[model samples]
Target: MKRKEKFENRKTVRKTECRRSRNLGSCPAAEVSKLQKTVNSFAYTLEKAHFLDYVQYASNEKRIFRRAFLTGLLRGFGTAVGVTVLGAVIIYLFQALAKSNLPYIADFISDIIDIIEKTRK
Candidate 1:
């Protein structure tokens, strides 16, 4: 009979232990600490992630691209300047020739007018 009583007491203790464990899930302290640890770990990893490395890599790529862009722009500008200088020289030579050949001025003017009219048409 005493052995049966001991077994019943042990069963009661086991039942209470199971109920306590289930209630722990609803406990405020346990829930708060669980959430706190998760938040802390997320914040730590976020702080550790490197952003400067990405910025430096982007800046280096931009610098290389910008350098190439500037080089191409300067080359195009130089070619345009050379063409303009050649055109100016040609125009100056023709003007000089026209001054010395007064009779040709009328023909030159007629040719200029025809080119303008053709381009307009």
Candidate 2:
């Protein structure tokens, strides 16, 4: 058989199995109670998690903009501080190396340090 016919046969088999497994006409009250319990559980979960408040906050344009601006500002400030600290540590290491016994490497590191200091000045 073709792929479409095989898929339709499988679907029909699944439907037959489902119908045989559940006699819904004879269990209306049980079905309604089960459905009500599921709905209540879902609502209780949403309320506990404050899902509505998050939705409201997400829907407000001004709050979103303010949050984004603060996030960017903090990220930029953090990056600047981190780069400054890293540069200072690297320069300190270079200065230490400049005082070592390796003459050629010391000279190169000292040149770099001097250039950096000049740029700062």
CA RMSD of each candidate after superposition: 17.8, 7.7
Q: List pairs with backbone clashes in candidate 2.
A: none
Candidate 1 has a TM-score of: 0.35
Q: For residues 1-121, write the lDDT of model 2, one tens digit per residue.
A: 9999999998778656645666655444655578779999999999999999999999999999999999999999999999999999999999999999586999999899999999999
lDDT of 2 at 12: 78
Whole-model lDDT, model 2: 0.88
The regions of model 1 sitting more than 4 angstroms off are 1-60, 102-121
- Which portions of model 2 show Cα errors greater than 4 Å? 1-27
Quote each prediction's TM-score: 0.35, 0.68
Highest-lDDT candidate: 2
